[model samples]
Target chain A: MDNSEDTERIASVLNGDISSFEPLIAKYQPRVFATVRRYARREDEIEDIVQEIFIKAFRKLATFRGEAPFEHWLMRLAVRTCYDFLRRHQRNRETNLSQLTDAQNEWLERFHVSDTADSGDAVAARELVELLLDKLSPSSKMVITLMEIEGKSVKEIAEIMGWTLSLVKVRAFRSRAQMRKHLAQLLKECPVTVEPIKTS
Target chain B: MNTDKLWNKLVDEVRKTPSGHSVPHDFEKRIMDRLNSTDAHAKSGDSSKIRSLDLLWSNLVNLARQATPNDRVPFAFEKRIMACIDVPLEVVDGLTLWSRAT
Candidate 1:
């Protein structure tokens, strides 16, 4: 649907036509599901977060001033809700060396052996990245996910999150450093044997 | 063998990994059901009671505001007690419940 259609549906919903919201939900569910999946792992948790986002959007629909497109406003709400979800579920996302899968451990071992070595198995590398991301603070995780994984610019992140540009930059820098530190620690803790140098 | 290089490599690999999950088939229906259920629950008399309580509280607040003497000076003991306590005194209206961690 176009902007005019969104405005009309929003008007209808504001006027107490509840069923008018279904079209908006249908249009946005896939995008919402994609965004929520980055933060939550379980199917049920993803669905819950998605439902909460839509429900919240419905309640706050009256506040839309039409200054921006409805999609932009909805996305801003989505990102903030995701941040809250991350903060709320942070304790449960904790990861440690013991929780690493064998493939993840092997990938870490290869990285420790040589920084230039290929991580090779994309699936294991992705899981390892997720594990390290879980170890970060909620704010840091959101910053990293938006800036690095999602390829969002600093300005875009600031806009979506309603944060200052400087704050986003600082957060991006700090989160990268934090991720590096965590990776180094994991590599140090990983039990990889080093081959001895041969002599003549 | 820079750590930065390793992190960059891993990040590239992570980007290559597909997100791979789609929205469930019945998600829109579920959201509509939830919204409809919440609206129905809110309409079931509790809201009217809350509105009445809210209106009463507002009138009480207005009365209390008008009754308080703005020019009254603080008594010496009260001032001393206030000085001793660093925290500001807060009056609870008793309507809000303390939030518990989930």
Candidate 2:
């Protein structure tokens, strides 16, 4: 019944006071949502992934030793969940030029053809960046998202993914190369205007 | 082609992630509802599994009841089962439909 603190909330939840889980979810929902903002494609998908993370946390609550702050443990769980989510979606799907919105295609064309000026809308450019980033292999996507977007340190990523420091470094390098390669291919092949489908 | 410049540009732009996105307002209620529904589903699943087990047990009992020596065309059934491996049929007639469940 105590709704003031996370520790008491965790204790209450673990004690079968199922209603206490509401506070934990309320307190950490933002951070959990933060973990997948860049990685998840749509708003509903982000919510679904966040929901799954909380569900998993609820199921695995008994295993949560109080050795670390609950936030740290939750973030680690969040990271692992996002990594698993990316792995599940690692199927090879082609990223055609048509997938890009008209604005994104224009931005890509201008960025490639013109000078290195700031495109002003960092948001849109970032979205376009993710469009290409999503086409990479699962491991590559995880490495890049963990290293670049989330700004997690190499050691932290290593700990989270259970990979050696060197392995993490290698994966990050290869992932960046993969992203660059895809971007290069996209830039070379992008037509000025996408052709509309013609009906027979 | 060297795409390092483009990649770096994207990196710089994306680094400052905006803080406008917020967790949905009814997120807590939604999660509680989900947990309750999951518990309900698990309970229903357990009950259904028990019911199905009972049904299967009754099915087996019925099957055993009909397993009497005279209840089956044993020779015909044996030949039919063995015929798949090229064994010769016992040439028994008048027992082609020796099923009990019907």
Candidate 3:
């Protein structure tokens, strides 16, 4: 929807017409959920974070001027909310290096043998990466999630996160270092066999 | 750290993690329910305040509206304010006068 429609709906919501808020939620839910999915995975957890985002957005609706499209404004809120969630819960949810599943082990083993491997599709890759990423601190997880998983450039991530460019770069560097540490540990657990993929 | 081939492979794969398009079937309903509950809470709070104001005013009608709350408040406070209500308009300031009347 356009800016004026958003303004009208926002006015209605603020004016105590509660149901008018529904359209705004419906229109933005997919994008907000999709963006939030990158930060969270559990069905219930995702719903909570998504719900919180709307709650926050509603509470701060008065601050939203018509300067930007409502989606753009809401997205900034979504990203910030997700980041806040990680900061709050990351320490409590810390896990040791988890045992890889048989499927994961099989993928890793096959991957170990393939030189310059492009064999595994996206889903398997994402699963393996997410498993390792769980061990990183929340800030590192966010840096890597945006940089690699969401395919956001550092500058873009800075804009989305409201951080300086240098901060994004530094976090990216630390995130990469942390990921490499995880990979090194994983490789040690699962070694390569004698026959490796032939390189060009 | 070495730029290992594995890291690149993994990064490329994760970058392919798809963004979803499907929304929950009841997404809008969930938000509306939350908003409705909050609206109800605010409305209830306002109604309760109005109820309190009505109660305060009804007590005042027996005491007469001319009694300013600042008038010599007796020790019983409410009873004193009420007692002061019936006193002569000239007896506005003295708790001593209300004590004598009692």
Model 1 compared with the native: what TM-score?
0.59
- In terms of lDDT, which candidate is strongest? 1
Model 2, span A1-200: residue lDDT tens: 23237778888878867666665766666667666765666676676676677777877889888877788878888878887887877774456745667766666555434423343534546665567667887778778767765568999989888889999999988876676566546655666532211212
lDDT by residue (A1-200, candidate 1, tens digit) is 99999999999989877768777877767677777777777777776777778778887999999889998898888889989999888787657855678887676566435433342455566566667778899899899878766768999999988899999999988887777667556645767543321211
True contacts kept of 3: 0.00
lDDT of candidate 1 over B13-52, digit per residue (tens): 7666756644444766999999999998878555553443
Candidate 3 lDDT over residue span A74-143, tens digit each: 9989988988988888867754444666666665555545423343333444556666667788788888
CA lDDT of A64 in candidate 2?
84
Instruction: List, in order, the clash count of every candidate structure.
Output: 0, 0, 0
TM-score of chain A, all candidates? 0.85, 0.83, 0.85
DockQ of each: 0.01, 0.01, 0.01
TM-score of chain A of 2: 0.83
Error of 1 at A83 (Å): 0.8
lDDT, candidate 1, at B14: 61
Error of 2 at A1 (Å): 15
Model 2, A16: alpha-carbon shift in Å? 2.0
